[model samples]
Target: MGGVIGLDVGGANTKAVWRNGGERRAVSRPFEVWRDREALAAVLREVVAGVAPEPVEAVALTTTAELSDAFRTKREGVGFVLDAAEAALGGPPLFAFTTAGEVVPFAEVRARAPEVAAANWLASALAVAAVHPDALMIDVGSTTADVVPIAAGRVAATGRTDLDRLLAGELVYTGALRTNLAAIAPRVPVRDSSCPVASELFAISADVQLILGHLAPGAYTCATPDGRPATVEFARERVARLVCADAEQMAAEEIDAIAAFLHAEQVRQVEAAVRRVSGRFEVAPPVVPLGAGAFLAREAAEQLGRAVAELPW
Candidate 1:
């Protein structure tokens, strides 16, 4: 069989993996065009054009694009997918956003990969089951963490119910990017006062990750509502913008204090996520961590008191 391309289109980035004649390479680009499908498709076309002289073989795609409440219905979401697929592949790429138990055509595999309703951890489970057959699969990404209970080669679905599903210890809303530190915790201990961090329109989880060296500064983008690329100075400004008050007038100590506050909150959220899953599963957790944010995974493992196994991505 000829090598194919696997694209995982996430909320903050578009990840592309190419298997060209047994050689594998991966690229992740900023998903700044996520809010606008047309622009995203144009970029995808450029990426595809750069890869091959002609259309390669079949293309595979997985997406979290539809999850945005912006599109009210699945039909609209599907339409958006089809549009992008047509732009990149010269036709619709098979979609695979799905749930467990339901079998989909090979063409639809990406879109039909078990969803949160059945077990959002399906992708992580599949990725982990290849190696760790009998362990809790903790797939930590930039925006969320998913811990799935795996036994043998199958993923144990707690049920199809969303509420009960959360009780299964398979979903955590902490990722390597795009999360809000303010959402992680309200008060973070600084040099002095327990600074109560306010949820400003700035300071995404990516900034915290960048400061901790989990993500490179070059990865930062100004893909805010303004659509400009975020510079290092701009990121600092955004990070500073998270304060309840004006950041322009804040002292250097206050800026450091805010960073300290966010760092503390980040750790706390990881700890809370670990505890939430460990208590429910009642089994020794398996830390099968992947994603660009490596530091966060290690910290999460340390806080959770679990063995860490890095995926060879």
Candidate 2:
């Protein structure tokens, strides 16, 4: 088989996977489309080139970046992304994956653009279904967690669109790197007292994970809230600000304990969504964890006593 490229263009990142017969490769780059929509075509070309040295024979695309605030409407976002892909890939047989779990021609995608907007989760779930038959796909990325069920080798999701998925508990708006600490919990235990979290973006989940040694400094790719470094010392300082205090006001062990608390809180949030999504099935399915926050998925799975099938990505 010739080289076939699959792209998942997200709001904060662009990921590409190249499959050529027995060889397969993948690449992900931080390309916040809302920050610069004009650069998308260039970014796509760069990602494609990085994944596959040779020219690609065909292209399959899925996107959640359309929901980015860069565009006024979803239709406009869809059209812009489609145009960018065409510009980047030239004349390859282009296909778009829809929320319905089917790959349609680019012409169909343009005609029914709403069906394909933010459908990368469905595409990923379908891909996992083809291999596992019966499993739960949990993709915890930088900003969100997608809990999709795959039953009998098919995508068995309760909702299609982002809004619907959020309502159905299939989409949790918290992730590893970019999620705000305030969103994780309203109050966190500090020493002997429970302090209310400051309602500010002073720190993110990345800081919490970094302070707890869950993530390395280099692994925290998202920008810090205070525009500071992502090192452990800096992360501790960031977490201290969550309680409206500076690093000097708190001891190192106190900040570390807070980080541990927030990490467990985030895990609880994901575990709750997993239970809601998996409750629909008669028998519990093994969790297929994907993305950079696979550790969170594993923690949630262990809490539920479910088996884990780690994705090869």
Candidate 3:
């Protein structure tokens, strides 16, 4: 056997890992599947090519992209993604991990499409659980955050689906990027005064993180809200618009303050979810932070006074 490539195709990004003879390489690319579903095959091909020059022996697939608004139904989304993966990988032995924790063949996934939809979090959590017996997996991606509990070397998650995860406080919609500022808070402080935020898509979390120096211009893979450059200057300009104001109208320090406030609010939101999941375990477990926004996870863990374990990505 050559090696197995694991893929987690998401709505806003595509993540892949190539494992061969104990050597592994992982890569994530910005690919808005909803905006350009037809380009998925090309994106997949590019991602695979980045990690492995030769043909992969097999591919294990998982996805949250099927939940994108591009498809009318999840069945259609699953079929489309499977087709693209097949075409991109040249029909290598393919498998899809399901919410039931089963890796079924591509052919079997059609009948179990719902189970396979948005199950990437489960796959990640299970993989972590296999190594750490008692821990909380905090995966904060660009568009969402997952808080999954692992107890006794098993997945102690309460939710099997995204909806259920949301209800169970295991899934938080906030992330390191792409989240609307309006969703984070209705208003922000501006020099001792609270200013109402515009409900429009004026700014996203990426802009906030960019201005706060948490992310670099190149690290922001998602499209900017104003279709402007991802530079710190432009990001500051976007954050200024959250209050329906421009950079000229606000001082640089004022804009930075707003970004700092929003960043704290986001951390609070993720912390709430982390606390909810942590309550399930008898004793506090070490938090294993994963994904791009691992800093948020580490901060949340520190706030909860728990030990931290960084996931080797």
Candidate 4:
């Protein structure tokens, strides 16, 4: 038996796992977007060295970044990924994943509909089924949480990936890294009266992750809309600062209030998701949670009155 490689290219970081004779061996450094193509390729080469010096027979790539219109306009982002893939595998069969559950050939991905659910949370959920077989996998990654139902080792697909799908409980958009608290809750208790949240910061569901401990400092990717690293303290400061735009700012009470508000809203969303799948699967489907934001996922499951079987990383 030869070796194989699995590469998950995300918006914030790139992860690679090398497997020799079906046994996992080594991994790579979390490649930040600040690094150039040459640097990323070097990192990949380093990760795959001991397992396979040259290209393997196949390379399965699940890219959440390259498919976004945000990345398409940049031009260099997807191209750089292709460059890295070719450099590593000598261009062997490259499979691009999508929320639709179809493994698209590289040529099709490079030419059309890249902006669709290419490597959406649904795709990650599918990846989980290959191992768990009959468990519901909830992947709460940097930007979204995907709750997928798996039975008989196949991931169920909804054929939809729009924001409405997420709101309707067909998908879970609440993530660890990039969701606005305002979106989570419009009215938050500030002082004696409820104050409407002001939309200003690029803060995401990650704020909830930070408070919940699903994510740590280094786990979060840098790249604030202004293009800087986001420190935990920085996130806290910005969140705290948002409180000041109103009369509630004087007491320094709005920060905690907002955190509490966001946390509750996240719980609401998770409960709604479990309800959506309740008709099809068990009221308790042996939840298998994975991702950078597993801690929050666990809490979300509890909100639905279920227990989680968290995978060991």
Q: Provide the overall lDDT of each model, using Cα atoms, as 2-decimal numbers.
A: 0.59, 0.90, 0.89, 0.62
Model 3's number of clashes is 0
Residue runs of model 2 more than 4 Å from their true location after superposition: none
- Model 3 regions lying over 4 Å from their true place: none
Write model 3 residue lDDT over 1-313, tens digit each, in one string: 3688999899999989989876998889999998889999999999988877787788999988989999998888988898899899885799999998999999878877888899999999998987788899999999799999999998999999999999998999999999999999988999799988999998899899888888878889899988989998988899998898898999999999999999999899989998888877788889999888888888888887889976655
TM-score of 4: 0.75
Task: Report the C-alpha lDDT of model 1 over 20-98, residue by residue, as the tens digit.
Answer: 6647767767765446756767666665555443555656565565555545654565456546766567642343435
lDDT of 1 at 16: 67
* TM-score for candidate 2: 0.96
Better of 1 and 3 by TM-score: 3
Looking at model 3, residue 291 earns an lDDT score of: 84
- Spell out the clash pairs found in candidate 2: none
User: What's the candidate order when arranged by decreasing lDDT?
Assistant: 2, 3, 4, 1
lDDT of 2 at 214: 78
Per-prediction TM-score to the true structure, in the order listed: 0.78, 0.96, 0.97, 0.75
Better of 2 and 4 by TM-score: 2
lDDT of 4 by residue, 54-136 (tens): 66666667655553444444235666665676576555587666556677666676654443333555656665777777777
Index of the highest-lDDT prediction: 2
Supply every candidate's count of residue pairs whose N, Cα or C atoms clash at under 3 angstroms.
Answer: 19, 0, 0, 4
